[model samples]
Target: MTFFDEMKTTFKDIPRPEGEISTLEFLEASESLVKLFDLFGSSAFSVVQNDMKGNINKVSTKFLSDPINCNTLQKLILLEIKENGKKVATQGLLWLCRGLQFTANAMRKCIDNKDWELSKCFEKSYSETLTKYHSMLIRPVFKLAMKACPYRKDLFVKLGDDLNKVNEQLEDWVAGLEEIVDVIMKFFESGNYGKGL
Candidate 1:
């Protein structure tokens, strides 16, 4: 399998017990993940944007939902990188980061400025859901992004920070961040932690 596949397997299988993953090993793995996600992000956004240039609501509900169709776009990104050059790959990935930052900022604005309870509730729900399901997904992505976007400290930090914000919002969001290797630790019962992973 390719590195991304290796990553998927690593992501799916829980991290080892007790011992910490070597910081260097983690950093290298993080680089690959960032590069790949960047690639995935650029292509996916481009395709979706072009396909729905005039219909953004449709785009969100259709192409960009969670557990979305990014899988295929991800593969395309990896394949292109494998076949092309690193420069091309990096460019694509950078674009992806920009897109993510834009969306995240917009989401933040919407969260802060709500005219209705429903809007606030929707923001709360989305944040909680992603915070619940996506800690595993977002951490490595952030680590990778940090490596990739060294100059853009704000974006990297903000994105990384987001992985933790939801649980804080819910209080349950750490009442989370307390799991074994899991980013958000699920509270099962007293003294027993259930991992969101």
Candidate 2:
């Protein structure tokens, strides 16, 4: 099976919610995000702002409901990134991070409003998606990006720090990423990656 087929088999199996934004929708959005990353493989990683916004909107709206405006949530994430985001040679990286932030925010909103089933479904799909990302997507891209830039920028750290100023839901997300950061730091400390940048 193809990668997308595998992704669909894994994520689309998630039990559906009662809204437009189903677990399948989120999974599709994640798959789209990975497609955006694939552009990097062809050295075509630039993003036109309008297209980026449209793509994010398309994904965010999949299961949207009252008080859960995908556009607003996406805008909030972009705003945070614009205010405190860093520059990377690849624009897909920024989009990927922002998309994940938006997904996390949407799930948090579900959890906050006591939509237990949908929230739990989102958590399951997201966890699986992230696992695929780390193993199938991020590792190769990270190696390539590190080679081209040779400097690692923790977008999550910068994002978490900024989001902390205005959003509380990210506390756990940031904490999780920070733990990952600690491991990366240890890897760097081992001098296997040629000193910290």
Candidate 3:
């Protein structure tokens, strides 16, 4: 299928078959999915001015607002669009982001509800998506950002060190969520997701 076709195929609102993993790999994979989702979802909190909300709020009042599809995510994503992607139409990217954001929401729901049973299917699909995204999206964007962005070596200069700081903070927050997913996945893969299971 063409890239556009693949993109269209990815973001359907189909509900995944949710259930616990009978294998250890299932648990680890589940965690990987959640981690990837958080990493991607975090863009909303980092780039968008008003969007923020994650479990990190369990501690402080930092990212309690919803940042889904806010300005920041749109800006960088737009800035990083490729030539082939350029002709894909604006709605294409919007759909892509919405689809990704929707997946992120599902991962977050699993985390919030502590639904280990359904997490198994989520783990498998999520890991695959992350791998595909890294190859097709994230890696390409970084390469383009470093070489293609007009700022080049000086991109961070005008943005200030605070940009990196914010990015780091976002990473740290998402890392925690990832750790939980990883542990959960590992547990089920090992047949022990719960403290004693």
Whole-model lDDT, model 3? 0.30
State which candidate, 1 or 3, has the greater TM-score. Answer: 1
Q: State the lDDT of candidate 3 residue by residue for 91-128, as single tens digits.
A: 33232332334344434443444433323423433454
Backbone clashes in model 3: 20
TM-score of each: 0.23, 0.21, 0.22
Extract clashing residue pairs from model 2: 20-62, 20-63, 21-62, 21-63
Select the stronger candidate by lDDT from 1 and 2. 2
Ranking of candidates on lDDT, top first: 2, 1, 3
**Candidate 1 whole-model C-alpha lDDT, 0 to 1:** 0.31
Query: Which of candidates 2 and 3 is the stronger one according to lDDT?
Result: 2
Q: Model 1 residue 108 lDDT?
A: 44
User: What is the lDDT of every predicted structure here?
Assistant: 0.31, 0.36, 0.30
Worst 10 residues of 3 by lDDT: 55-64
Which one is best on lDDT? 2
Question: lDDT, candidate 1, residue 64?
Answer: 35
Q: Write the per-residue lDDT of candidate 2 for residues 25-130, one digit (tens) a residue.
A: 4435445434423422334223222334554454344324322432232333333345554322113323444445534443454336443443243345344443
